[model samples]
Target chain A: MPQTKTQVLKIDKLSKDFGYRQVLKGVDMDLAAGELTLLLGKNGAGKSTLMKIISGLVLPSGGKISFKGQDTKKNPQNLRKSLGMISHQTMFYGDLTAEENLLFFSKLKKVSSPREKIEGALHRTGLRKFAQIPVKTFSSGMNKRLNIAKLMVMDPELLLLDEPYTGLDYDSIEFFNDYLAEFKKKGGTVLLITHQIDISFELCDKIAIMQNGVAASHMKTASYTYDDLIEEYQKR
Target chain B: MLNKILGIASIISIALVGYLVFFWAPIESSMGIVQKIMYIHVPSIWLTFLALFIAFLCSIGYLWKRAEIYDVVALCMVEIGVIFCGITLITGSIWAKPTWNTYWTWDARLTTTLILFLIFVGYLLLRKFMDYGEQQARFAAVVGIIGFLDVPLIHQSVTWWRTLHQPSTVFSTKKNVIDTPLLVMLLLSLLAFSFLLAFIASKRIELELKSRKFQKQIANLPQDHH
Candidate 1:
């Protein structure tokens, strides 16, 4: 029998407004430990806004965001150490080589003697050969892989990815998929935002569709067929 | 709308101040017509300092509050401050050629001012090259706050070191070095330049805000094809 996992994050009645525009309206979701959830939405549906709020990059207009049983607002600095983010933009320093960038972030995360961890992450990303190369010289696909490597080295409990597959080669995407599989096996939680639902639906355990700043529909990945999701998505 | 009103007001005041400087204010007995350039030169430098100070404050506000509005305001101030500082340097160079017999000097005031200008220029370059959003904003804010350390040093340079540049006449505790009419004209010019700074900064900030919104709209557009 399958076991239910503990809740790792709970977002309650989250609301965010940018000036006169309301981006998130009463968004409520619970992310369970070890479950990979795909957030699907049309354009301007506030999916990125929800991710930003979860990562503490943007503050919500009203609501509570609790991470690891504590309010994130109460101790953001401490909470930040346990969270890693990946987006279209690379957070690594272009001036630094891949190894150096990994070392720097690992040190910031207070990882003990990070050299071995850095090597392991680089090896996992299949970037060990290019570890000495400057990140600015890397291609877009390489940068995306390095971003995942950086997150791996940090070993965050929760990973928030926005369009994680935007500019990856098939081989790179396969590599990331394997990593995600192992990550979920180890009880790590992931909340991913992507428009490429056809490919992502395979790995996702749950699906949440956002429409006009709220969760319009949510279902288990096994319960809904790919056509069912596409039908539900179109109805929104 | 406010920017337009401020822009027209500034243009009128600037023209009026120019007329007063050349024709109404009594010419200096020592330097003649060349000394009149002081009216424009001093005010530009003053406005430059004012803009940077405001930028410094806004940067701090951004870091504390994590508000994008503060970041936009801080960026506008830095851009305007750099332009006005450039004017100060050029006008000062022209004045130096006639008064000090050279176009350049290693004087403390000039050296410190140049360094301040270069630092802000670096700030702008960072903004241009770095990826936009929260990460860029955080790094820029830290640099902005630290770069302001040079401000106090620049302000005190002339008094701290022997230099060809004259000590501030308007700001000095010493009895007014400039004539009564010249001082009046200088005050008027300062007012005009302050208005000009306000007008330009507001316009630039408005443009920045619009560009940001446009980028957001583009980002939100459906990428189903991807």
Candidate 2:
């Protein structure tokens, strides 16, 4: 028997350069539907730049990126609706209440019944009581949860997260893991970028190691033990 | 190379205009050499408006296309426009000292221009304070569009209200108010300053592109020593 999965994203020979220095050099990756792929890299491995290009926030200097069988360069706006991103910076407005932030994004995304979606996202993220409070007053953990709430309201087919659990506490981390599992169960695709391998080891279905502007290797988590992955990283 | 050629052309034409204004363009019957500042003042004001108009157009393009190149051009033009606006105010003040007997006045034309300058100053400050990316570009483009609405208002202020600043000479219905030599010099000054604006804009845009590349390189540098 063989496992076959639908490919949600296809990145071929993707390369990005900044002046004399090249960040991504002919990198190729494929993310399948309902799969959580952890992209592991050391600092400055060009993970964030790759995610930015995928989300249409940045353009690649060379190569191609196709999402859902459509070239990103040709149909960026159409592709944007299907992709949600959580990066190092919070995309919410600090002066606006948590509910207001969600409402604003929902309208931009043209979600149906925005009011209902806002309430539902807040309740699910466990921020119902703090819905009316300004985002500036929220704790780091609370803000991270609100970012997840943003993803829920949009209900994107693909989610790209860059260092999603950087400042989260134990409880928040647990909550995030549970949310990601549920999201995958609903047939969503995820490409999580992180330098910390231990944190996302169990949650990821596959591991792709990025080195020298390329994915050096990709392996299934089931086939490789924790120590085996570490040894592999060292070899690279 | 184009920028360099434009820069040289600007210098030559500006020097030619200066010689024509001081020697060839005859002094007015009433005002003497003080009227000469008009050669510098009017052209600076015209070029300022031109730069701002380009910025407005580029801003619109940036919003519609969401391209980084358009945003870079808009930012460059806005910065150049502000510099020209500053030159206009200072030169106008110098001309006013002997002609109007005061370096400063609260006349409608002067006041509206000042307000316009202040608005653009705020625009530049907004760009400076925000982080660079799509959000910054979006916000700046919106501000650029709104701030440009003041240009027409500034142009029409002298007509809408009775001001000590004289009404349009070249654009007025009156026939040949300015002498032929003065008109030639003014037009040449306009051409020279416009060239200068283009040259500066291209240079600034080059710097902007380089700085963006540098920033990314710095970001990719290793953070932890260990």
Candidate 2 residue lDDT tens string, B93-178: 89778867789876556666787788889888998898766667888999999989766776676556643455644234323467
Segments in model 1 whose C-alpha atoms lie over 4 Å from true places: A1-7, A12-28, A33-64, A77-205, A209-217, A221-236, B154-176, B214-226
Residue clash pairs of candidate 2: none
lDDT of 1 by residue, A14-90 (tens): 98866445678888888888888899988778998898999998878789988888999998886698798998688
lDDT of 1 at B123: 96
- Using Cα atoms, each model's DockQ against the true complex is 0.05, 0.07
TM-score of chain A of each: 0.95, 0.95
Candidate 1, residue B155: lDDT: 60
User: Of the candidates shown, which would achieve the greatest TM-score relative to the real structure?
Assistant: 2
Model 2: CA > 4 A from native: A12-27, A43-65, A71-186, A193-203, A212-217, A221-223, B1-8, B61-76, B130-142, B154-176, B192-225
Candidate 2 residue-wise lDDT, A78-186, digit = tens: 7788888899988789999999999988898999998888788889888999999999998878888999999888999899999999888888788888988988888
Q: How is the predicted docking of candidate 2 categorized under the CAPRI scheme?
A: incorrect
DockQ of candidate 2 against the true complex: 0.07
